[model samples]
Target: MIYLPLLISITEVIIVTVPVLLTVAFVTVAERKTMASMQRRLGPNIVGYYGLMQAFADALKLLLKEYVSPTQANLVLFFLGPVITLIFSLLGFSVIPYGPGLAIWDFDLGILYMLAVSSLSTYGILLAGWSANSKYAFLGSLRSTAQLISYELILSSAILLVVLLSGSLSLTVNTEAQKAIWYIVPLLPIFIIFFIGSIAETNRAPFDLAEAAVIFVFFFLAEYASIVLICILTSILFLAGYLLNFTFIVSFIKETEPYLYAILVDSKHETILSDPIIEGMVYGLTLGLKTCIMIFVFIWARASFPRIRYDQLMSFCWTILLPLVIAFIILLPCVLFSFEIISSNIHLL
Candidate 1:
């Protein structure tokens, strides 16, 4: 009896983690293919069917590569850096609900937990660079630390708007709040801010000042894993997760609900439509589709834009994005109160 819960937890961890690791692997291939098409060049087509196996091959190669360490580096902290990054990046997924009751560790403060975990990932980068005992690596880490800190403010502010409207810090609650309407519909500017901040937060190109020391597979995995997780978070926060909540789709589904129920239900038993397994699977797919769309946008931005200089990056964050985000943060509440549109569930502290 004592081991039962432990076993279940371990199983849950596997279920949540394996797919993310797989997605992180293929995201690399997808980015390559996406960029190749954009540039009118062929990507890794020869690795497997349309290069689907390219990521696996690359993983194998990385695994087989010789490990090298800086002679003067603090070996403990050096190796610990990537491990810290990858663990914290993966930790954010535990609270992200894939569907109803599908999260590994759903809680009321899931959004806050994610933010905390993500913030910790920056420390790993800083440690990795500083521990490397190399001038260039240390400089790169410093740059990343500064960039992540700057953009995180804009991202957190944008999320606060969603939290205000939803009246909850739970990601699941945020998704449910959007069942009739997505936050993106009214908070488009905030969504834009959030999206750009996410790109910078993840060190994506055009704002990729933190992309260094990719020779370490752990670093590679951590980076891509963060990218995928961020995309999913974006979808859940702004796009309504699996529910979508589009008016036409909602009405269309409503019109077809009976037929879908009749077809999907087992006549001998109750409808599978309400079955947790079936509902979870369907919702999972819907959320996945949204996440994929967000991932494509990430890749698209990478392909479309060139990396900005560090000074320009800092200037844009402080001079442009910070001011705009601050204004939105200040004005959004007044607008909500003036319109009497704030959720009644929200309470002043």
Candidate 2:
């Protein structure tokens, strides 16, 4: 029995970890290709058929590179920074349900668990900045930290709307609640608010401070890892995951191309995905497809938008997202009551 449970856990870890790592890989390639397309150029066609192997090549390069720690730097925290970053960034995915019984950890406090894990990455960034013993690194980390804190508040406030509407903390259950009608229809404004907050939370373009390319790439992976997680979460929360109530993921992908490109361009979303096995696959595919669209938006924004001033960054988060989220949170109950959609009162704390 003990051996069986251990083996099952190992299997589950493989199930969740491998696919996510692979998704992050292709996300890098998509960023490049999308950026190239934006500039009216081709991207990564030489490296293995449209640069499919580019991400893998980049990974191998990073792995082979020597660790060059500064002599004056605090070695302990400096080294620990990446470890902490990679861990917490991947850790948040544990609670995100991918499909029917697809979650690694389907606990009642799943949303809270993700929130807590997500917040912990800040320390990793802080340590990376402070331990480097470089003035540039310190200033960059300060700006990153400020962006994290301000946007995280907006993220949480937006999540509070989900809690009120769904009346459950588990993402799996919340997804089920949206089977009839996706939350995006009723709460489109809040959805947009959360998404914009997600963009800032992941420190994509505009909010991102331009820094040295070498070290910034390391920090980029860490932040972008969380971006991968949040993108998936956003799909589940607003896009209705596998239920396919609204083929928004595939629909959004159609924007960048005639059909859904990148991840799930496997032609298009078929409406007849009714079989359980097929439903699960479609569900998982839809989630991945939606997340691909989200990631593309991340890269698209980076390519198109200019970096904003720090003061403007802080002001937008507080003045715009905060008040809007608050208004929505207050208005949500009235909407639910009027629509007669109120469910069990789950703890919003």
Candidate 3:
């Protein structure tokens, strides 16, 4: 039975990974097409079927390209960098509940697991920079390391708010809590902070200091891989990844049955329309769509904003975002406690 479950997990990983990888591939193509259209230029029309196969062509190109290693580079660490990044990036999906009880391995410490895995990905970047033995790569790596570490603080703080509000570290539970109102409304500031941190974490435009290329298209694939992971994580965290029903339902549920707001409470147990497969599909699709949109916004930002200086970037996070986030963390509990006190007084009256 254990072997069967393991086999099933392997199969599920293959099933989920193939589609996601394909989507990430084509997203690049679609992004280029969209950008080209905006600039009034013909995009990849020469490839198969309006350039739909262009992504595949690009993949082939990359595969065929020489894996050049600097003579002084630490070959083992340098190669391990991308492998570590790719593995950690994919590991996060295991806990991301696509639907109720539909994840690959739903655990009690799902959120914490994700945090640990995400933090592990930073070492890959650090290794890449240090291994390369190039001035630009080292600088890029330093910037990336500092940026990820600092922004991770803000990210974890924001996620901690959700964990506190929902009172669980499980992704499914978190999604269930949002069935009434997405956490975004009550935690809008955290949402914004998380989003900014995500962009920085992925090293997207305005924060792409790590792989910023003045002469060469340096580590472009690795950079995009990081961005893809950030997009996935963003969907998993803030957007309520497999949860359906809107903010109105969440609000209604909270107003009427406040006590039943646990993460996986299943308040609508009496509803007739319950299908696990269908539910899983819906949740997966919802998550996939949200991720796609987030990735689009990432590309849009890259197109729209010029990159900031490294000092300005670090200053913004430490001076502005970090302080604001700290303040919110300190204040949120007090506000909630005050509200509870006021409610209790009214009832006593």
Candidate 4:
């Protein structure tokens, strides 16, 4: 029985791990394809259909390449850095629900789980920077850590709005709270802050993504992974997770229309599923749509914007956004109180 349980656990892990590995690859292709369309050029046409296999090819070559460590660097930590980073990247996904029946673990503290796991990725970079003993790598790591830490507060503050409204730390609960209407409707400003904060966390703009090119593969992989994960995290926090409805200002999709193919939503536009297999697949796709769109915005921002002075990033986050979110937090209750959003709570406060 113990062996059987172990087998089942391994199977579950394989099921979750395969998709994440695949997603990391395809997001790169998607980023390239999107940027190419924006630039009016052919992105990747040779590998598979319109170059779908390009990511796979790139991954294979990267995997097969020789990994050379710096002679003066800490050998154990040098390799360990990337390992730690990749491990944390995969770890966070376990808490994210694909649908009602999916996810490896549906912990009640999912949001906290995500935040804690996400923050650890920085340690991996720091390890790599120190292990490599390169000045550029170390500086890049320091910038990465400082920038990510600074932005995480904004992320948390913005997310705290959702936590307050939802009354739960779990992403699943926060998502359910948005079933009737996404928090984005009432929390547009906070939503925007979350988006910008996410971008900053990934070290995309106002920060130097190119500066760490010397660290090359590991740092780069972690960077890309962080971007995509941030997108998914945003999809859960602001938009509804696999809800099949969005409150964004405008969209090509219909209000009731399913974002995924018919596999997920019935003809009548109902999203709840009676069939287990189809429910899981459809929910996965529905959630994928939101994550994909956000990832596109992330790639687009990278392509369109020029890097600003790093000091400006700190100034904007500290001087501008920090105060802004604090004021918003204070202002939210007052507006709610005046409008009768919180009657008993208002009096108690």
Candidate 5:
């Protein structure tokens, strides 16, 4: 019986990870295709079936590509940079509930865990830039440090709005609170702010100061990896993960029945199983669809926007995003209080 549950957990991880990895892989292809169409050119038509295999070909190329290191550079830190970034990026998946009760770990501090892990990716980027022993890499690292630090503040402030409204740090609870109306509707401003902040956080175009090569071909693989992580985190946070309906609740009940039965009896276990799995699946699908849509939007922004200058990027984060986020934080509580007062007076009417 214990083995069964363990197997299920492993299966869940594999199922979720495979699709997400495929999505990340194809997202690159889709971006190229979109950019090609925008420029009125055919993109990757020679590969296989509308260039669907191009991503695989690129992966093969990267795998075979020789990795050279500066002789004077610290080999340990240089190699550790990509490792750390990749690990941190994967860490976000721990707290992101993909379907009803589908997450590998569902800590109550899910939101905080996400923030902490996401922040670590920046350190990896900085380390890579400094250890490369090249001026371009060093400058790129400096730009990334400034950009991530400035935007993270705005992103955290926006996330705090959701935490405040939800009254819980658990991603599951956050999604539950959005059952009737997504926080996006009530907190549209914050949603927009978070969306843009995400773009900056991931160093996407219009905020991609870290990879401003003269030919625009300078690829920051570590930075791009971090961006994919941010995109997934965004979907998990605002888009509502697998708990779109009461599916998470139903799944929870089903999964915990053994422990409940061990304590109570067969009657209680049967009572829990009365909840239908079909309902849970429907809700889980709803949440999954929302997350996919959010991911698509991230891709859309990348396809549509142009990269901004480093100074302009800083100004946007500090002068624009910071002020707006601060305003929302200050105003949200007041608005909630006014709603309470108005509700009380309506009863007197």
Candidate 6:
């Protein structure tokens, strides 16, 4: 029985992880394509149909290359750093739902778990940079540590607002609360802040100082994995997770012309859509589309904006974003009280 449960858990992990791994591979291709389009240039087109297989080709090339370590570097920590980073980056996916009840581990404290896991990725980065024994790598790690720590405050604050509204720390509950309307509608400002914080947390442009000293392919893969995970998280927290409501359109069509509605919406449509397996597939697909859109935004921002100076990046976080986040933290409760819209589910801290 114990072995049975362990086997089931392993299966669940495989289901969630394989898709994420494939998506991370293609996200690199998408990044190239998006940047090329933005710059009005051609992207990779020779590897496969419109460069579809370019990511795999690149991965192969990376695998074939011999790793050359620095003479003075700590061999153990140097190798261990990227492994640690990749492990923690992948760990966040255990809590993130792809559809209803579709996760490796869906616990009540999932949000907290995600936050804690994400914070640990920085330690791997710090270790890798320090172990490299290169000044550039060490400096990059220091900047990343400072940046991640600073922006995490903003990220947590923004999530706290969502938690307040949803009255649960679980991402599953967070998604359910937005079934009628996404949190984005009411919390647009907070969503914007959250999105920015996510970008920074992922070490993406214009805050990509962390990648300046990349030493291993594992580091690269780990970063991309983090990007996809963060994008999915953004979609779940802001958009309703896989819950689309087209009832208004259907109702309007039915009211206008009953015959047309009967022709357009038939038993087959209902049967296919209502089937549990099909419903789960559709929900999973919807979530994938949402995640892809967020990933594109990350690429778009990278291509559109220049990397900010390290000092400017820190200043923006501490001086501007931190203060704004603090103000919202104080002001949100007051607004909630004034409107009597405070969630009954919120536990007093």
RMSD of each: 2.7, 5.9, 7.3, 4.6, 8.9, 2.2
TM-score of each: 0.93, 0.86, 0.83, 0.86, 0.79, 0.94
Better of 1 and 4 by TM-score: 1
Candidate achieving higher TM-score, 4 or 5:
4
Q: Give the TM-score of candidate 3.
A: 0.83
**lDDT ranking of the models:** 6, 1, 2, 4, 3, 5
lDDT for model 4, please: 0.78
Tens digits of lDDT, candidate 1, 212-257: 5434678778889999999999999999987844345535654879
Residues 168-261, candidate 3, lDDT per residue (tens digit)? 7787877776766777788888888988888887777888876662112224554565566667666666677776673556567667876654
TM-score of 4: 0.86
Candidate lDDT values, in order: 0.88, 0.80, 0.75, 0.78, 0.71, 0.88
lDDT value, residue 165 of candidate 3: 72
Q: For model 3, what is the alpha-carbon lDDT of residue 236?
A: 61
| Candidate achieving higher lDDT, 1 or 5 | 1
Candidate number that wins on lDDT, 1 or 3: 1
lDDT tens readout by residue for model 2, 1-349 = 7699999988998888888788788888888888888999998888788789999899888888887878899999987876787789888888878787888888888888888887888777788888989988888788878788888888888888887888988889888988888888988898899888888877677776523311645576776687799888998888886567546655776686663354444445444344577678877887888888877877877898898888898889888788888888788888887887777564324
Candidate 4 on 162-265: residue-level lDDT in tens? 77677687778777767888777889999889998988877675465434434556656666777777888888888888876433412333444546435444
Candidate 1 structure lDDT: 0.88
**True lDDT of residue 8, candidate 5:** 87
Q: Residue by residue across 1-349, what tens digits does model 5's lDDT show? A: 8699989888977876676667667767877887788779888888889999898898788778787778878888887776777677666777776555757898898988888887887787788778878788788888888888888898889988887777777887777666666677788888889989988887777777655621111134444455556665665566654444344554575677756544432544443334567556665566556655765677678777878778888988889889989999889867876766323322443
| Cα lDDT tens digits for candidate 6, 219-338 | 889989999999888998899877767577568878998887887677765534557887788888888889889999999989889999989998999998888888988998889989
| Model 5 bad stretches (over 4 Å) | 1-15, 213-229, 243-284, 341-349
Tell me which residue pairs clash in candidate 5. Answer: 99-242, 206-307
**Top model by TM-score, which number?**
6
